[model samples]
Target: MKKILPGLLLLSAALSCTNKNEKMEPYKWPDAKAPIADIKPFTRILHGDTVVDNYYWMIDYFKKGPDSTKVVDYLSAENKYLDTMMSGSKAFREDLFKELKGRIKEKDESVPVFNNGYYYYSKTEDGKQYYKYCRKKGDLNAKEEVLLDVDEMAKGHPYYSATGFSISPDNKLIAYGVDKVSRRQYTLYIKNLETGEIFKDQIDNTEGDAVWAADNKTLFYTSKNPVTLLSEKIKKHKLGTDAKQDVIVYEEKDKSNYIGAGKSKSGKYIFIYSSATLSDEIRMIDASKPDDAFKVFQPRMKDVKYDVVALDDKFLIVTNWNATNFRLMETPLNQTGRENWKEVIPNRKDVLLSGVDEFKDYIVLAERKNGLAQLRVRSLNGPEHYIDFGEPTYTARIGSNPDYNSKTVRYIYTSMTTPISTYDYDMVTKEKVLKKQQEIIGGYNKEDYVTERLFATAKDGTKIPISLVYKKGLKKDGTAPLLLYAYGSYGSSMDAGFSSNNLSLLNRGFVYAIAHIRGGQEMGRYWYDDGKLMKKMNTFTDFIDCGKFLIDQKFTGKGHLYAQGGSAGGLLMGAVINLAPDLWNGILAHVPFVDVVNTMLDESIPLTTNEFDEWGNPKDKEAYFYMKSYSPYENIDKKDYPNMLVTTGLHDSQVQYFEPAKWVAKLRATKTDKHLLLLKTDMDFGHGGASGRFDYLKDVSLNYAFLFSLEGITK
Candidate 1:
């Protein structure tokens, strides 16, 4: 600990030390010779096609043996090059980091959520690197009990994360999933709350989530496949038992489906959801009947998707059965099949039923219309009404409403201009009381910023939504710089919510835009459907088209536009650049999944087999040709590319670091122009870099610094 402390403190000092002056040069480009990765050509044959990859040896990064491995050496060289290149902006980056950190209240606590007999919340002290999980018995005025001091837990580890935090019904024992490797695999630990003693029982390599059964001694957890890292089995573990003795209560035979177990809001049942990209199946086990078998609530059907929420004597189901936009359905608990399900809320093409939450008498439906969230609340037998949120571009959904019998339901509201606000809506009284809104410690005025919702037409004539925000006085006359961002995969909506960190960009005369492109459910199921599989080109093309529209609409000039995305979004950045390399002045791709064809073809890779419905099976010749056609790595041409900053964690489990390492190597070898390409690999951490709250800001600062340097906005 003493050995690591000095170096860490020095690094902190370097990052926190800001420049006294704001005036600076437009940019100081990294002038050092780029590190060229050694080429060892490897041949890959798939679907009767042969390809040679020169950087294939980079895959040795995952191999165990020594840090001296050639792969490690190559990555280290790149890191050194990055450090050398960005050395000029170290102080500037630090200044950005300090300012970004200043916006956040260091000593902050989350809204207390009442559950069972306790009100639980997490708090971060001023100097702490992590939060402390705490709870109060019966009321808010009661004495506080610390459940888990994550700062203490994180003391000795470089990377630490608590995956699942669950407590026994009696509240005597707390079960949590801990991950020290940052690989998304966690080990379950049981701790006695009263005695502050951790038990001997340890369950490893799980999905990190555990659902407690009514039988206080029993816990059900999902296990991840060691090879693919996909949740494949649910095991029943009894307290104090050897992990080897855990029973495999359920096993998902389909490798494509991910299985998970969770207790219902009502706490009456533990539901196991097994799903793939286009299909879903749910099985429910009564909480009281921990020893009984789990009964299938609905059989899996191709293209069918649904989630179950247990109610008093029935189950509320949000499903897309014969409904592209999804609808609400209910069936008696005993009649658990789809045939017995009856419509509660019929499907509407204009609206997408995203999810549902249940209270004793009230049912809250999280709906989305025209790319905005709408929460509809109603009683099982009373009038139904939509919770009004007047913001044009905001994200709102039910928050932690754990107590099933409570009359008040909590929901969080946020827009690009509003800090996160939590509200307690009394379903009975039809009144919303603001619980809390995050405080941006350093003076922040929402009025100083302006937000706009714009649309761009895709090649197919599909209208794509783009949410933009910038400083109030910024002009749309094409002089301003813009950073366009999007993640058009997995049907995840990139909501236009508040980000205190992003204020750095908006305040700097930069227009920040989120392209609600296809592949995201922003415009409902069809939006996602049109962007994936054989139609996946829409994801890339839509992003490109959005950039063109922004340029044409004079939001930003052609050379002033920037682009950024991570993980799958990183894939977007990679593709858009390949499709329209001249559109962006700079591009940031973090932990990018750029080697599409190769990655999808490799079933042993995490999420590859499971995401076949998303990327499609390369074993199928049709899927192979289509993916290969647009794969960023495979499609790389000897053309000038954007000034690019690519980042990855050496320990990344999703989208292996080698993907970006290899992609950059190819770019350096093939690109016609020397448009600055920088790759920074964090030796520690995984897909989600720097687990520490404030510590993570360093990466953000570097990214912002990179963008600022390009635009010559050093201040």
Candidate 2:
């Protein structure tokens, strides 16, 4: 075990002092000895670069090697240390958890989505951990039939996930998927709604989606590789037959591409999609003819990604082949080749065509313009218009419109200050009706909050959007604490949305902000293209600039500002800390992916091969050096770092548990700071913390307590 450094002694001494004028005493963390991990030096020579990783043995748990037990012991020790240090906040953490959970409506039902001849919805009970999937046939007042009692099914499991509920064409049989261990490998099961009996045919190791043919007996699902957990093959299964006899319909030859099976909304064709980051190819077969061979819609082209939506006589294609912002094209149902496609909506430099939801009389286009979502409704007869969300910064997207014959289109709208709202709009009348709005158990008045959309200038002269919300009448005196969050990777935009848990911070005088940095498609494909690969530094720099901008504007000072991100965004948190450690007082990284070079270099990782286009593969010398340059674990130095709370799940398959474990171990040994560095690993769950909605708030409460304790805002 390593001895405590002088810097840690200084930190302990400083904890005794507090502001004399303050009303409450400053939080004094327990002086418990942090567990020091034993270093087992491991060396690797990659692209002529020699590196020695002292904590590399932490990866043994996943490999099931002799050292696996040791890795678990190390992680357990870290968890115990965290508990000991935070023991002072036990009651405070409970209060925070209850406060955050209290705002959520315990008994709630989602707006019923009318599909085929039935209206399907899920409702949660007061004290239950899960909801029940129920449906009503014929009309909204019809008799309710309970399909799945997830609360009962999840009784004995520590983690449970039920998803991908697909009903047969005749609506008599239902296909669903379940994951008990939270590793994302779901087992597909079929249940007869007419007779409350589950079939004996159960298929394991699937992607959790099952598309049914018109025959109602044939099911198509994507199979996953047992080792890497990658979606590798599409297979067909007969209702009563053994899953072992399932025929492989399509096997993805390219390891980098992921494949999935789905039926079109029109129920006319079944599609098998093979997609990578930059390219994709689609195959389709008639849903009525399950035994027929599938035909390719279009051959895969380099750097081209196109999704198809089947229409009555034609197929609509949203492709980025010749348009950087993507354009809408159409081809006859029979002639689905690139050469036969004709442009319908020409690409605009300012607008990005993200998706299309087709209906009988109209098609709604999900678009992004200037970092905000827009729903454009276009009639088959040629008139088009966009739905007005009436917020400066908000997210608006097409919701569940399963009924093709209905003229009303459903959409969801939410902003930083607004609760999620569902609306049904009549395309012809141009009017909308509010179907439902999220109810906050405790009274919530939007007038008590102030939401703003501001821009921060990046180092390269690009303007980055910053959406923030705080209690009304906030003083710009740089005395308040602020939490800044962002997720900038894989073209996934972090849009402004409402969170009930955020009220805890706001009510406590904390300003919550989201930095819309590059690497996300907020500003279109160009924004994402410029923030990845060689330009990945832009993501970290943009976040730093946002932090500086907030401080410059007197919103918060350097020592009171906090930053957070998760998964790839967690990578963002790791990079920014290494780049500008003094810019933040605290950081909350959930299931962080911090070991960039090592994780990317190893192809056996769950998402490494699939994300080669997002995070360049390290096999190439250029990619290796670039990734190594910013990897948080590799770049740790003898410098002060902000207090941090890092979280990961031991069973996580996406980012893996070892990445953060190795990262925290290295940071603890190398950093010169005496500040808090904590790691919390949920042994039973995976990438996503908990299976239950309410139970997840415990993790959130822990994070809030950490931030609050640092700012001396204990409840």
Candidate 3:
């Protein structure tokens, strides 16, 4: 008879695979733990010009408390080992170069917008900012130079900062924003990218999102006073020796409304959409004066109830909500004026319009009819000629603007089960060619990984979806360590996606799961509406239900389970830990919004009032009672809870570090056992613990080490 050990038994066997001779010695764990450094109240995190990409990571850290901030670059020396981002080793750079070169070449060339070849980073040293742009192309030595010196650019303005920049297509002028003492209000500046000379004219506290018009001299941006979504106005600014700033368009002032602006393809017209209260009705604005570049569009869209998708000189695609389902409706640009409206694509009951892109004679619609989301192109130049791009293996999500080169349309595709991969679909050839594939994060195989959707009944008998991922072959034993994750707030859904880092856990014999609870839009708007304000406790109970369901199915035991969530989900994690602390072995709360009541009470905080709709205002008695019910900071009680590791950032403007600090302090004072409450705050970084990639991974590795330690696997 042949005997085979189950996965749990095998994992336990593997964890003990260390040398017996070493195990014989007394366990030597690091005695000294890194102390929590004292942080200043007004510390700010720094961000790099480089986007958070695959091989590169940007991190901000404070060597000396809040007074100084430094940005560090983390480059993965090799794709083989997902390790450090910042190291003074030359061998690491060589490995990084080899991996980066391989990945860069795989990118689709049709979308020749910007390459992640150069490093653009700015840092403030000795109260002066030093900006540099370095590019390493081919065998060419690294072309690195100072792009701008902060002191030379803005002369008189005390404490001038440049951020949110966009470069002209010709790469001549750089449109950067300069903020005063208050980061909220900023003025736009036109700086010569090469000369580093800036001319500030359209400087106003109300100025917001800006984009360069094709003319480069003309700037189109959204501006508003007090920066409210309700009263935002779109304006145009001329940038030259002598320029003018004017309100090319103005939206109706309504507290409960939101106005969004978009430009047409030909630049002949600018489209403005008005949503009085709900994001439904979209009105178009045609410039009243076509000759003046800073002209406002006429305010009126035909009573056609729909959401704008794409607008061009020829056609406009909109997601129209009929009596039942959301459908795609297209109208000719010529007839889409104030009183004239004709539907090119009429409303269909079953189809849910996702997105659309327009070319000269054709319009491409990305729609989800059944469960399938595919791209469909319709040519209006001829009769109703249409072509389907076939059902993609995964859903195809189109960006705001997809690059079209000759006869090819390039876009990206990904699904709950597929890794994000880009492709270029040839319009004429009707062939789909793969452009780039994400690195095949090894250590685990897809065939061994299995995902299933389960609905668990909560305390209120409401069914919540739980996405579970684990190794395929596992016995129905109550010994497997389970990591139940959830983020149940702000209508943010924990969608299915691949993570190279998560692969570490799967290989180490852990079942990973996400509770798609209420207070999120995973299912729909109603899900979020149900779990916020007075009903916020539902998030906690739903998470508990997920854990209970796993135990009921004999997948995990009480001491072998862990609950984790971050941000709003962090609130969920903290609440659950306090409510039922004995249920889990450990918990990880990352940049959590735990101090709910106090934080929401102050309107001065960023995103506080804006979130009033989500979390009821604490001022009202009814709201106060309900909000305090599940707020982690307000509800800490005397109990022997599981070990918890809470993370926060001193520079975090969104979820202040004080919230977690207060919560941890109270938890320590109240809890009976020495419930190892570790508070790690990145003094220089914001909500994200670190700015660079390697720094993030290092923290992540430390977190996992702590978690694994609680499971009897310590260094």
On TM-score, the leading prediction is 2
- Give a tens-digit lDDT track for model 1, residues 10-64: 3344333232223445686756999998877889987779999998778765645
The sequence of per-residue lDDT tens digits that candidate 2 reaches over residues 1-715 is: 1222332332233223322214444579888888888989999998788999998888899988879999999999999999998998999888777666667777889999999899999999877889999999989899999999999999989999999999999999999999999899999999999999999989999999799999999999999998899999999999999999999999998988999998888999999999999999999999999989889999999999999998898999999999999999999988999999999999999999999999988999999999999999999999999888888998888898888788999999899999999999999999999999998664678988899999999998999999999877778888778999999998999999999888878877789999999999999999999899999999999999999999999988878899999999999999999999999999999899999998888888897899899889899999999998998888999999999999999999899999999999889988998999999999999999899988999999899899989988767
Q: Would you list the C-alpha lDDT of every candidate in the order shown?
A: 0.88, 0.91, 0.56
RMSD (Å) per prediction: 4.0, 6.2, 11.5
Preferred candidate (TM-score higher): 2 or 3: 2
Candidate 3 Cα lDDT to native: 0.56
Q: List the residue pairs that clash in candidate 2.
A: none
The TM-score that candidate 1 achieves is 0.96
- Estimate TM-scores for all models: 0.96, 0.97, 0.68
Residues 1-715 of candidate 3: C-alpha lDDT, one tens digit per residue: 0111232343343334321212122212333322222222322122211211111011122223322232221111111111221122234233322222222212121222222233343433322322323223232345544555554554554334556565554557777666543234557777776776767565565444466556666666655444231235666677753334464555445433445555554344555555531233444444433235332222333323355434444445463334223355445554544244445566554554545776555566765543345577566465332334342223355532423213455567653335566676666566777766554412224576676667789988887877766665655587777888888886565655555455445555677777888886555445666787778888788889889999998778887799888888899988898788889888989889987876676655555655676788777868877877788876777879887777776656567655666576567557787545666655455675543223355566556665655554432
Off by over 4 Å in 2: 1-25
Off by over 4 Å in 3: 1-172, 176-209, 222-236, 240-306, 313-325, 330-396, 404-411, 414-418, 426-430, 440-445, 459-463, 533-535
Q: In terms of TM-score, which candidate is stronger, 1 or 2?
A: 2
Residue 273 CA error for candidate 2 (Å)? Answer: 0.6
How accurate locally is residue 47 in candidate 1, as Cα lDDT from 0 to 100?
71
